[model samples]
Target: MKLPKRPKQHILETASYKLFSSKIPDEWIIRDITERDYGIDCYLEMVNDDNELSGDLALIQLKSKDEIEWTNKDTFTHYGVDISTTNYWYQFPIPVFIFIGDISNQKLYFNSVHYTIKRNFDQFVKQTTFPYKFKKSDLFEGKDGVFAFKFHYYYEKYRQQFENELRFFISNLQHYKDFQQLHNNLDYHLGLEDTDQIFFESMHKNFSFLCTYFNIDNPIPKLRDIKKKSREKFGNESHYELYEHDLTEWMEEYEKLTINLIVGMKSFLNGELPYWLRINPTIYNYVNNIGDDGTLPYE
Candidate 1:
């Protein structure tokens, strides 16, 4: 089944934020993350180790598979607008960064907004290219809007790459046997006995986080529903029927993103963590009158 774009982006971003916040310091905060226009989609605010109010701003531009290849240069711009050309980054305290993750093109690029500021200089030739590693501390200093922009740009870029990888796994709906094999392997690796609840519950939590991030009211679709919808759309056919008359541009994008979401979730279920815990570690440890040996009673 196809997944929607807004929710897919939300899940990916939320997951990354969760991981980053967990791994990183508590003072650094992620705020105002959204699909908002021209403005920065996500912001990081905190007092740096130097005790400065170091803040970062970033814009995220999403590209579908086809758009990834066909998109013009503007697609690479932060917030879908050229800050360097317009010198908008300098207008605000928050620095600007642009992140582009193109799954179809398999390209991930990050560029600083200051590329515009220095582009007119003789030594500015190097600003045109994307950088693999950016120094965050250097950018966070002063009112240097470029640093925050680049920070967000890289963060969203990583977010998009992760979403694409998860989506790829989610799109292969016909591969249940592969999922089963993965499930078995994870169960074995985790030394799990009852795998069903752990498998589904951890997934449920992950999906719930994604849904919350996107503000999606109906995030978790039943697997049976996915199969039903898949049959309706593809049937015995190998490809989806794309008719201009049947769906709007936005609808088509939403459908595809939704499909990706489903596929990604299924892929996530067969991972090691859920299989190890059997989705009931909390119940096993904290709750009394639990079943023997960590396996849930029904499982």
Candidate 2:
């Protein structure tokens, strides 16, 4: 399996689980898994204190995307495919842990639209009902259940491109350290923790139009209005006033996010992701061959 490099948040979450597992005795087996064919990325095995395989399996669903908007279809389909696959070890009710980026601020509306998925799933699993019950609750329903959704939300607008172009850029970004570094620095400076403060406090859903065209969570703010207001309040130092008055000590935050984005784009040009994530192999190869000018068949 060609293991692609995931985001910092995913790495952190995975590491935490590993650390937690280390406390367990060796009789309890813990292993990192990457089930690509099933869309089941990485997870750990939890053994009992008695060093017996008590038929317990813990799965962590990790998603690394450039956009904050995640639809019901994406989650259902990804996990549905994974769970639908026959796995004797995972036959028992397993716990799915979702580690998402930008969870600190964003209250994901999973239930509002997840009904559509649940209804479809009921039909899909009609013939077969596992012992565990399907959840109809909000995004974070705690129980020994199947399918947990999560991601690390980022708003890097400078690398915005058409959806197809952006997809290629993201896939190719796997190998680039500079791009990875930029992401790390951005997370550090922006305080990318507590999904609520990072997503719920701002205009999250309003950027769908931008995402459609730009492939990102970047929205053009009312800078002209801000400039005028700054001029009136601070007089002459208005350009600097935007930072001084609006954010106070947020300059470092703004600078890091902005510079990271700028650096990320440069890294993409250097072939960071290695391969763009393909819905299928044909599409993957077709896009990968496209040259810098966006024309296909690089050679």
Candidate 3:
């Protein structure tokens, strides 16, 4: 009797799966569905530390390479594929992440396939076997549950209905209470921290729409500048050391600006949110109507 033989393809793919399994939190579950023969190789479901399913899920398309190199210096990683395959990936209801593992050094690089379509659809459609670039920053850092949290955030956004965009916009503005607390607490800014960098990024992620909502100058940059200086002096050694840079001139102004933003947020939270929900046109009206009806048509 003859026995079945394993091909090089099987060994390579199995190695890739093993690498991915190691990076994820042990609490998470990876269901291998490669036999299904669709584009997806696995369904990754996250389990929260509380030992319960977090209901966070994503589709994975795994590709393996040894010693992955950046296509353009360290800017980004580009992978080429036929337009039809991208067209196929775009149809998924949920997010599809193209996870490329560098088996040699044990690093994983990933980017959302749909994100490519959404960002460069026009040019993308015009070509075939296009090299889609993925952000270098998105490479797995191998620690901190940041990737898991970010996965859920993007997945949640994908599941939201188009009608919820405005509500999301309002929601982003209504929630600065946590930051406001830090703004008032002077001791917290003694040194630079990861959260400080994240704050600057998160605060300004929606800045284009934010400009329409809040007209104040962005204070995040100044704080981030302070953070950089602290990093220069102290490195990531600690988050509580005294900053060499003086905070006297900007602290109060920064607090006041933050408070004003809070005030604006409150105004929108109490005012626009309800209006957006039910849309009482009168509250948003600028024209005044007179019972006499005999004057100029406009206010």
Q: Best by TM-score, which number?
A: 3
Which candidate leads in lDDT? 3
lDDT of each: 0.38, 0.36, 0.56
What is candidate 1's TM-score against the reference? 0.25
lDDT of 2 at 152: 11
Between candidates 1 and 2, which one is better according to lDDT?
Answer: 1
Give the count of colliding residue pairs in each prediction: 20, 24, 0
Error of 3 at 260 (Å): 11
Error of 2 at 47 (Å): 6.1
TM-scores for all predictions:
0.25, 0.22, 0.51
* Per-residue error (Å), model 3, residue 219: 14
**Candidate 3: worst-modelled 10 consecutive residues by lDDT:** 286-295
Candidate 2 shows a clash count of: 24
Error at 187, model 3, angstroms = 36
List where candidate 3 sits over 4 angstroms from the true fold. 1-7, 34-36, 148-156, 167-299
Model 3: per-residue Cα lDDT over 1-299, one tens digit each:
99999986677678888888888777878887736456688988866659798776778878877766776656554555667767777777777777777788887767777655544545565656656675556676555435643553364344334224334433443343344445454553454355654654455444323433444566544445655666676667775433423243344554455445444434443433333334433322311221122121242
